[model samples]
Target: MEQQPTADPRGAIETVFRIESPRIIAGVTRIVRDVGIAEELAQDALVAALEQWPRDGVPDNPGAWLMATAKHRAIDLVRRRERYARKLEEVGRDLSLSTPHHVDEPADPDAIDDDLLRLVFTACHPVLSAEARIALTLRLLGGLTTPEIARAYLAPEPTIAQRIVRAKRTLATRGVAFEVPYGPEREARLGSVLEVIYLIFNEGYAATAGDDLLRPALCEDALRLARVLAELMPKESEVHGLVALLELQSSRAAARTGPSGEPVLLKDQNRSRWNRLLIRRGFAALARANAVSTGVPGPYALQAAIAACHAQAYAYEDTDWHQIATLYGLLVTRSPSPVIELNRAVAVSMADGPEPALAIVDTLATEPALRDYHLLPSVRGDLLARLGRTAEARAEFERAALLARNARERALLEERAVGLDRPAAEGPAGTAAVRCGRAGPRSGGQ
Candidate 1:
């Protein structure tokens, strides 16, 4: 007789950990009613899989295995407490108590698909402040470790630790539900939820830590989640706007880096490498955002509109800076931010001239928010260079270079300042200045 074949051990192990992470967290949250505890239990399931899968051979249905493992752990814990025992009953009829949701095969994809979304809405629920929600959601749904989350946020590990702990405690004490919102509350929370997701995606698109310039995995994961949200919430215009934004932004990944992983400025980047399909999708989404409006566009829609402005141009010179300046003006009114104003200054420079842009920037020098913002000096340098003020420009560039966290960004800024030290006849500033100036718009992920 032929020997029976075992399931692909590594394949099953990876799939179980990857695809099931979100759903398992969601399912666990329903039972525990505490996202932090649910996440810990989910890790317990992950640990079990890592220990068993390689030895027992991969299960034919790995997601079910992980879910089963988490549920069994829950049952064991709840058996010791009456209150927690009631929790098991609350999660759909004590099947969690007797038998977990796992079976010999995968569950219906459609049925379990909503788990991730539910987890997102719950973790992003308005009960938590913005910082708390983002920290907790990235922990539970993004599958990132607390340390990783800390590194991404540029916050100390202890600070991130405290925030997550406080967030979980708040949720439990307040008895926040682990389900989607309803009625007016649903619409109210949707925008913040979407904003959190987009922020995660952007962090991954351009990493702020380590030696890596891009963390493509995080970006793709975020993009996948956004696409899912767009499909699930098709009626929400901002949902599509976010999806469109991610799709279009990600399309440039291939060309955003040079031969050695150095950053590539937009003007110098090969436009041919950009994905036309994504651009089209982005345009359509902007149109949708417009259609849903009785008045001004939401933040995401306005940002998408701004991104669309860049996408419509075939070349950098062909871009409509005047219209971009106009969009930034509206963006400021809807969402007043120094960062947005900094972005607007770039468009203002291109449309009017360096003088007006410099004046506008000078007005923002005292802004508390822009005090540590490297782009402020970076923008000032570009405008100064445009007006034959190289000495001042060099100082601004050097200041920007010191404040920049990204290695590639700092290198480019230093290079520009060095270049300005040499004498040359004044004309238009180099393509590099224009390119580096664009960094002001994107570097802060504003």
Candidate 2:
């Protein structure tokens, strides 16, 4: 029997489409061999649903109905092309587009999973630029609209629109294969895919330039993708590692901001606000990653370990900074990035003292990669203030504020700079005033 019609059919259509669009597009792409065409066909399915669902009543399995509609359209398009015979042979096994009795029979689970994985690899292919990969992945897999993506990244809608269009065209013209690679090639491509997801989460975790410090939707989307990838590749240790890192970092979202949406430094955040469920999930993922490791842990696993350290501490003062600093040392060896080094310095400051950590920061000051990085000056300012150099510390904070793009972060830095002017007895202790930049590794804006 057909389900009763939804009172808000359009709203129901939108909600279902948003959840199922990625699967619909992936299944269609398997048949059409073109993401751009697959997306258009998915939209066509949405149009059909809008016109029919209200009149006929909603289907019991709306997602399957939409997927079936999109897949049938894709088959028809393939049959119309001049090279129908060749294309049909290539995708012949997947051409079983006969109308089902219920119009809601789900596709083979294994096939659908393969199609989704292929779509992830295709969207994150090395052939596309980083920005293009990000825009396209969010569009196809994250089910984000162009305007939503543009707003998330603070870019113009037209620029994002053009970037996505060109990315699809580039993939088609270059004949990028829609399949997961193997061996070393797979390893390299996997890195690209992971990086794209990481970058997306980082942007949401700490917006580079925006009125708000956090974009929770982006974080949710990225976390969803990471979870999907982990399920799809359960044996891949780094996949679990990425999931662990994201889960642990996201657990702090509730306490990262104050009542007015101002930034909350790590030392000041209320630990009770952290999501205990996500923290437990993060720990399980980290354990899975460590269990599967055959050698030294990968960069993500190491980072997850560092995050786990923070989660284990009930209070800021109880945190095991020595272990965190040690993990950063391991991370530096595995990743060897200036940003990682900068993060290590922050951990070192807490583990040892400001003087030793300041020495480490001074060494990085001349590194070209960190010349314009705001955290460099911000971290330095914290150390200087701790060491009784108020004048230099204030100057560093002012410089950091000038370089910061996010309004909230810039205001925080400016506040620190101005606070130095207060009389010694009136002002908070220098150690108390120090901000730790990002609460965790790679979770802050550049």
**Most TM-score-accurate candidate:** 1
lDDT of 1 by residue, 1-446 (tens): 22234555666565457546767777777666677777788889887777766566565566777887787777667666656656655765523332332256554455454566677778777778877888887777666667767655546779888888988888888888877767677777776678667766755566544455666765765666677776656678778777777777776778778998877776767889888887887677777767766667776777777777777778878878888889888978887777677777777877888799889889989986566556678888878998889899989999988876667767877887898867742322322322112121152121
Cα distance off (Å), candidate 2, residue 189: 2.1
Q: Model 2: per-residue lDDT, tens digit, 1-446?
A: 85776666997898789768878898889878899999999999999999888887788888888988888787678778866677777777865655622764677766776786688789888889877887898788767678757644446889999999999999999998888777667666787688667756776677666577877765775677788888767888999999999999999999988999987777777999999999999999999998888899998898888888889989877888899889888988887766677777777887787888889989988887456557778888888887789999999989988877778888888988897776432112222222111223243211
Clashes of each: 0, 0
- What is the clash count of model 2? 0
RMSD of each: 6.2, 7.1
TM-score of 2: 0.68
C-alpha-based local distance difference test score of model 1: 0.69
User: Would you estimate the TM-scores of all the predictions?
Assistant: 0.74, 0.68
